[model samples]
Target: MDPQTEGHTGLGDWTPEALGAGRVLPVVSAPEAVLSRDGAEVDPIADETVRLAADLVATMRVSPGCVGLAAPQVGVGARVFAVDVTGHAKAVTVHGTFVLCNARVVEASRWKVGREGCMSVPDLTGDVKRASRLVVEGALPGSGQVVRLTTDGFEARALQHEIDHCAGLLFLDRVAGAHAIYQRKVYL
Candidate 1:
C-alpha cells in the first residue's frame, strides 16, 4: 500500500510502473459492439489485465486531447481505464497518470454540467451532467492493491467518463436531448 494512500483518500506515492512498456493500441470508434456491452471484471494482477492497463495508458498519451481512455475504447471487454488530466485547462485536481481496474464511484457531489467528447464519437460533443467532486475506489492493475481517490474538477470528470464507458455508456447516453449535442468544429 502507498504510505500516503494507506490512511487517507488520495493517490499518495502510487503509480502504474509495474505495468511497464505499454504499446499504443488502435482506438475503436462508436457503434462498436464492445463499447455498448458492459465490461467484465478481471483479476487486477493478472498478466492480461496488466497488459491492458499499460496499453490504455499508452493509447491515451498519443490521442490528442485524450486525457482518459477505457479498455472498451480499445476493444477490450474489461473494466479498466487510464486517466491523465495533467495539462487540461479544466482540471483542478490533477493525478498525473494512473490506471484503475474495476473502478466505481463511491461518492459523488457538486453536480455540474460540462462539455464532453469521446474518441469513439469523434464527430460530436455533448453537454452532460456529472459530479464535480467525486470519490472512487479501485485496484491497481499490477499490484492488485485497492486504493481510494478523492478528486474534483476535470480529473473527477475524466474518471466519471471512463467509469461510464466501462458500464456501457457514452456521453451521448447522458445528454439531455439532441439539442444538447453539437457538431465538432475543431480537431486536436
Candidate 2:
C-alpha cells in the first residue's frame, strides 16, 4: 500500500524509500525485552526512521484485528507508532492511517472504562480506564512537522494504547484488577 494515500501528505515523498528496503518486520510479542523498555525519541526526518514508520504501517495492515502498532512492538526502541481506526465498528473518529514520531499525550479527559488489548501481549485483554478524549502532539515522519490530533472514542483509546507502549506500559499494567483481566477471544 502507498503510505502517501494514508492521510498525511507530508509523508508522500518518503514513502518510496521507506518501502524500498525489502523486509516485513515481525511483531515482537510478550516476554520480549524490547516491549517492556521505553522507546527513545526518533529522528522524524531520517530515512531509517521514516522507513521504520512505513514498516509499522505495513505490519499493522497484515496483522488481523490490529488498529495500531508501536515501534517497541516491532523490537525497535523508538518512540513511534502507527494507527488507523478507519472502518472500525467502535470508531467514532477515524484518522485513516498515520504514523507519529516522538508522540506524547498533551491532554486527556473524560475518563471511561473500556476493554483493552495489545499486539505484544496477544494472549490477554483487560478492562482499563482511559480518557475518552485526548489531544496528542507529535512529529510527522518525513516532514518533521509537529501536529496535534484531538480525538475521542475508539480513536482516543487506540492513541492512548500506542502511547503507553512508547512509555513502557501495557494494558496489563492498567487492568483494574484480576477480575478485569481475561483471556483474549479469537478475532476470527
Candidate 3:
C-alpha cells in the first residue's frame, strides 16, 4: 500500500473500499472549461464532474491514506473536487461520496507551506504554501446543495490543493522555489 512506490502507477486497479476509496479514478471535464490566462472560464463542470468525484472517493481508500482528491489527478480540467476531513472512515461525517461543480476559492490565508504529494505526480513530495484556512463554494452532487465551507489545517490545505488541480494548477507551482522542495519520506 505504498502510494509513493517509485515507478508505480498510483493505486492502479485496486478495489474500491470505504466511502472514498478505490482505483480507476475519473478524469472529468475536457479542455474547454478551464480558466484562461485572463481568468475567464474555459472548462466548466459537467456530468463528468460528478462521476469523477464519486470515483475519486472510491479510489481514495486504495490511495494509501488519501483524504482528498481532485479531477486533474485523473486528467480532467474542471473546477470540481471532493474531500473527507475525518481521517477514519467511521468517524467521517462526510463519509459518502461528494461532487463539486463550478467550485471557487472565496477566501484563503497566507499560511506556511504544508507537506504535499500528488496522485498524478507520484513518488514525490514537497513543502508547498497554501492558505491556512479556506472558504470554498460549490454545488453538491444530486442534492444540489450549494456548499460554503471554511476549513483549516490539513483538511483545509488538502481541499484547496485539490481544487487548484481542478483549475489546472499543481502543487509544484506553489512550492515556493527549491528551498521548499523535498522527497516523500513515507507512504502508507
Candidate 4:
C-alpha cells in the first residue's frame, strides 16, 4: 500500500523524516472506518490517522509557512491533528510537532479571528473568528499523556484551525462573510 495515493483512510505522502520535522496532516472521512466517533476513549487510532499525520508533516515541511494541519482537510472525520509553529528556516529553540487524538478545546479566548487557510480548500483564504489563545486537552499517542496545551499567537490560531477540522468544522464556516474572503495574490 503506497502511502501517497491511498484512500482518505490511508496515510498519504508521509515519511518518517517529515514526522520528526513537523509536517502537516491529511484529513480523513467517515466511510474510511479508521475513524471512531468515540470522543475520549484510549482505544487505538486507525492506521489512517497515524499515517496521515506523518504525511501532513512532509507536506508542511515543503510548504512556505504552515503551522498546523487537520484531518478533515484530507477527507477523514477522525479526531486527530498535528501542529508545529516554528516558522520556516528560523532557528528557534521553541519547536515541536504535536500529534493529537480525541482532543478538545478546554478553554479559548474571546473571538480574535486571524487570517486562515486550509490544504483542502486551498483556493481562498480569509479572516476567521477564533480564540486569541486556547487551552487544549487531549491524549498523546504512545505515552498516553493527557496533555493540556496553552498556546497563542500564530501557533494558537493554527492549532484552533486544525482542531476545528477534527470536529468537522472548516474555516469557511467561521468566515466573517464574503467581504473577509480573498484570494492569494501570489502563491508564496
Candidate 5:
C-alpha cells in the first residue's frame, strides 16, 4: 500500500486478513519499560512502520471501548498512534480511524477535567485535566507528508491521551493527585 494515500481520510484502507483490513498487534500492559520510555521517531514510509501503524488501528478496534492505541503500548519504541472516536458517547468531533506518526500537539486550549483509562494501565482510572480543543500535527505513515488535525471535545481528549503515550507519559502522570486516581471499573 502507498503510505502517502493510506490515511488521508483519517481511517486507512487496510483491514484484517479475514476482513481484508489490517493486522492486529498485541497490546502491552503497564510497568513495561516500553510503556514508560519515550518513543523514537522513525521513517513513516518504511514498510515496518507502515505495518505497525496498521497494527495499531487493528488492535484499537478489537479492544473494547478503546478509542486509541499508541505504538509503545504495542512494545514499539516509535512515535505512532491510532485513534477512532466513532460511536463513542463522549465523542463530539469524530475523526473516524486514523494513524499519526511522530505526532505533536501544536496548540491546545479550553481546559476541562475528564475521567480517563488506558489499555496499558488497565488497573487504574483517573481524572485528568486536558485541553478541550487542540491542533495536532504529524507525519502520515506511508507518505511522510505532514498533516494537521483540528479537533475539540472528546476527540481532542483522545488525541492528547495518545500523544502522551508517544511522549512516554500516561494519564496517570497527568492526574491531579492520589484522590484523582481510582480502581478501573468494568462497564459490563
Candidate 6:
C-alpha cells in the first residue's frame, strides 16, 4: 500500500499507487454469473483484495459519472468495492475515493426513489427506492480496520448501489416494475 494513501487522514488521497498502482480491469456486463451470485467475503489485508480494491478505484475513475464499483462488476466475486461521489451534482456528503470490504448496511432511513444506472447494465436505468440516510459498517482495504460510515443523500445511495452489487443485485432487480425502468438516453 502506498504510504501517502495509507497515512492520509482524508479519504480523498486514494490513488492507483496506493494499492500498488491498480490497473483498470474490464467490466463484465449483466447476466454474467459473477454478477448474479453473492461475492465472497474477503480479507481486507490480503494481497489480492488490496489489488482488487485499487483496480476498482482505478476503473471507477475512468468510467464517466461512475461513483462506485464492486468486485463482481469486474468478474471477481469478492465483497470489495470502491466509491467516490466527490463532485456529483446530487452528492451531499462526499467522501472522495475509498474502498470497503464486506460492507453491510447497519441503518437506513429517509427512503426515496432515485434513478440509477450501472456499468454492468449499460443500456438501462431504473427508478429504485433507496435510503437517503444510511450507516454502513465495513473494513478498509489495507488497514483491516473496521469502520462505521454515516452519510446521506447521493453518497448513501451510491454506497447502497455498490453494496447491492456485492450482494448479487442489479438496480433492475430493485425497480418497482418494468414501467419504472427506462432506456438510458445519455451515454455518460
Off by over 4 Å in 5: 1-21
Which residue pairs come into collision in candidate 2? none
In the range 98-154, model 5's lDDT, one tens digit per residue, is: 888888888899999999999899899999999999988787777676677889999
On the 0 to 100 scale, the lDDT of residue 157 in model 4 is 75
lDDT of 6 at 17: 59
- TM-score list, all predictions: 0.94, 0.88, 0.68, 0.69, 0.88, 0.91
Report how far off residue 44 is in candidate 4 (Å). Answer: 5.1
Which number leads on lDDT? 1
Q: Which tens-of-lDDT digit does each residue in 1-188 have in candidate 4?
A: 12432232212233235334444445443333333222223332445445655666666566656666655555555566667776534323223666666777878886776777766566678899887767776655433345566666666677777777666566776897899998956643
Pick out the ten consecutive residues of candidate 1 with the lowest summed lDDT.
1-10
Candidate 6 lDDT tens digits, 104-187: 998999999999999999999999999999988787888776667789999999999999999999999999999999999964
For model 3, the stretches where C-alpha displacement exceeds 4 angstroms are: 1-23, 26-48, 88-97, 186-188
State in Å the error of residue 185, model 6: 0.3
Q: Alpha carbon lDDT of residue 71, candidate 2? A: 91
Give residue 117's error in model 1 in angstroms. 0.3
Score each candidate by Cα lDDT.
Answer: 0.90, 0.83, 0.57, 0.59, 0.84, 0.88
Error of 4 at 59 (Å): 3.2
> Better model by TM-score, 3 or 6?
6
Local lDDT at 38 for model 6: 90
Give lDDT tens digits, candidate 1, residues 83-129. Answer: 99998888888888999999999999999999999999999999999
Please give the lDDT score for candidate 5.
0.84
**Candidate with the greatest TM-score versus the true structure:** 1
Winner on TM-score (1 vs 6): 1
Q: What is the lDDT for 86 in model 2?
A: 86
